[model samples]
Target: MVEIKEIEKSFGRLNVLKGVSVSIPSGKVVAVLGPNGSGKTTLIKCILGLVIPDSGNIIIGNDNVKNSWSYRKNIGYLPQIARFPENLTVNELFRMIQDLRKGYANIAEAERCKEELVSVFNIQSFLNKHLRSLSGGTRQKVNVILSLMFDPDLFIFDEPTVGLDPISCVRFKENILKQKEKGKTIVLTTHILSEVDEMADEIIFLLEGKIYYKGSPDELKLQQQEATLERAIARLLEKNDNKINNQLPGKNN
Candidate 1:
């Protein structure tokens, strides 16, 4: 597990996180749903300490993030924007990241794992090619391979399936499920509603820098009188926003 309590973050005049709070249990896949400017990415950044929160706390496995920033070394993150120095062949990049990971965990066997993953993901064909020569989908595979390189305890991914082909997307989800079976916790955000319904054990709907709802997909659908998770989410947010508007200072409740 992980716990976030009333965490707030602001960038100048823009308040990205307005007292956001979420708790995720171990071995679960939690999906975050949101539209543009909804603070979903900001919340993830706060969790990773990439963006400092204005207040509140993030605790993971009994360790306070503020107290021990090193706790993050145990987590694997696949950021939305992945950048790498071009001209380096895929093999070289793998070696470099594996080397950097050694300093983080002092793992003596990381290179072995990296090679195995490269072959498993069918990335070997692209390994000798320079990064700039690969397609976007191939680059995405590389990004995912790198994030899962260490097989860290907690995996945080943003739009992980973007630019991937159908087969690759399915393979990626299968890998995530394998990680889930290993009792690893995962948090990710995606625009693909069907994938969220398929892979998520729980859902957190974020809107305007707040958690609109958090629960199982089944519970959400039945409550919202919808058969699909997508419709259910739309109903829930619409209902909540209607209530908010109804209670506005000059409006009738």
Candidate 2:
């Protein structure tokens, strides 16, 4: 579904992504796991064309993402932080997005999907309320609904369960699984290892703007000789840290 080849990005003195490359197959849930400053979000932005990479190719389906905007129409994106017009009511916000994407495949189907998502996320009671007045979890629910309403082919969720309540988080997982079952590609970035263990078909572990490990969760645990997904990732990071320290200037091997 997506292919990233030798992607590189920098911000003045800081190199964010260094020749990162990964291929995401269709109908799979891939978790992009990393610590802070690992360039997970940067990679996602590159794929979405929100941030252009300094070099490399991001090909979704068959088209390169550079200087392209139309590929986004087939991709549903839920940002890590959703910032909307504070004064707009939930209903109004929904209407605005529906209007903006009026060219979606089927108008009636999109509306029906929106209504279904509203009910599933249990946001009906707050539809009339302004976005600024909603709780973080509630707002996140609205964000999820808006992203899923159009039923895009690929779903990209960044920190999707951040503020969700336990039940809501469960519902969100169920919905994502349903989408996967229907053969939709999913790419998620989150710090929650347990969620990754539960939902991810493959894990792409990133560190210092590079893919440190990419495989199934079980394979990672076994490879690292760790008992749990969290421990496995921690061990990987520690090993990388030691390796880097050993290679530092004036350091003895």
Candidate 3:
């Protein structure tokens, strides 16, 4: 559903992505896993056009992402942090989004999923409250609802479960799987290894601004000789650290 080719991005002196290339297939859930500053967020932002790459190209379906905004109509993006007017009630916010969505995409299609998602998240009681009055988890639920309301073909969720309660987290996972069943492509970044094991069909592990590993969770675990995805990732990071440390001057090989 999406293709990234030799994508690179640098900010003045710091390079965030170095020749990153990967393909996300349709109807699958792919997780991007990495530590801080590993380029996971940068890669996702490049696809979203929030951050333009210095080189390479991103193709969604058949069209290139450069000089194009229409492809976004097919994408539902849940940012790690969603900022909005705190004075607005949740219902008002939802209405505003529904109204704004009309300009770029099918508002009817977007509305079809709104009620179901709101019910799934059980945020009916919070809708009349202002955003500033809601707890962190409640706000995150609103974020999830707004993103999925579009019923887009592609879903990009960055740190999606950050403040979600256990019930809400479970609901989110189930919803994502249902979307996958409907042939929608999902890509997400998260630090939670258990979530990756449960929801991801494949994982693309990033380290030092590049893709260190890409495959099934089980495959990665077996390759790293670890019992769980978390341990496997830890081992991979440890190895990378040792490799870098050993290359330092006067260090043992």
Candidate 4:
């Protein structure tokens, strides 16, 4: 459902994505994995049109996302760091978002989804509380609810389970599975290898602004000759350490 072709992005002297290409099919959960500064977030931002690529294209369904905003209506994005108005109460925030998206989203469906999420995440008790007063986990739950309530065709979650309690994490996984069953496409970025192992159908591993590996978790482990996803990823990184170091700025030839 998503296609990226020879995408490249550079910021001043720093190149973040270098001719990266991948195709994500519908109803699949794809995990984008990379170490710090590997351009995973930049790639995602490019797909969402938050960051424009210097070359190539990102297409969702048949729509090229470049210089476009309407395509975003089909995507539900949960950013790595969700920042909301501190003074707004949870209910107020929901109402405001609903207002902003009135013409785009089905009001009855959005309300039904919100009710289900509030119950599932146990957000009812804090509905009247100010966002500033909620704990990080609670705030994260709010973020999840906001992103999921629209029932968009595509879901992009960046560190979605960060700060979530154990039970909430389990619920989040269940929710993802439910979405997958409904044939929605999902793309997520997380440092938790275990979560990827448990949830991802495919993995896209990036190194220094390029795709290093793209396959299933099991395929990755087998390819790296490792028993587990964590070890496989570690081995892959270790194997490429020299290449990565040499590519760093100021490294002597």
Best by lDDT: 4
- TM-scores of all predicted structures: 0.91, 0.96, 0.95, 0.93
Q: Across residues 61-119, which tens digit of lDDT does each residue of candidate 4 receive?
A: 87999867888888999989889999999999999999988999997899999999999
Native-to-model Cα distance after best TM-score fit, residue 138 in candidate 3, in Å: 1.1
In model 3, which runs have C-alpha deviations exceeding 4 angstroms?
103-106
Which parts of model 1 have CA positions greater than 4 angstroms off?
A: 103-109, 244-253
> Against the correct fold, how does model 3 do in TM-score?
0.95
Which residue pairs overlap in candidate 1's backbone?
none
Candidate 2 per-residue lDDT, tens place, 1-253, comes to 9999999999999999999999999999999999899999999989999899999999999789987788888999999998999999999998888888888556688889989988888888999999999999999999999888889999999999999999889999999999999999999999999999999999998888999899999999999999999999889989988899999988884
lDDT of 4: 0.94
Kindly list the per-residue Cα lDDT of model 1 for residues 1-253, writing each as its tens digit.
Answer: 8999999888899987899888999999999888888998888888888888889999988888875787887798988877888989998897887777676864555666677767767888888899988888889889998888787899999999998888888888999999999999999999899999888999998988889889998999999999998898788878878998988898864
Predictions: Cα RMSD each:
2.2, 1.4, 1.5, 2.8
lDDT of 3 by residue, 1-253 (tens): 9999999999999999999999999989999999899998899999999999999999999879999988998899999997879999998998898887788767776666787788889988888999999988889999999889888899999999999999999999999999999989999999999999999999999988999999999999999999999999999989999999999998974
In model 2, the worst 10-residue window by lDDT is 98-107
Q: Could you say which candidate leads in TM-score?
A: 2
- Residue 142 error, candidate 1, Å: 0.5
lDDT (C-alpha, whole model) for all candidates: 0.87, 0.93, 0.92, 0.94
What shift in Å separates residue 23 of candidate 3 from its native position after superposition? 1.1
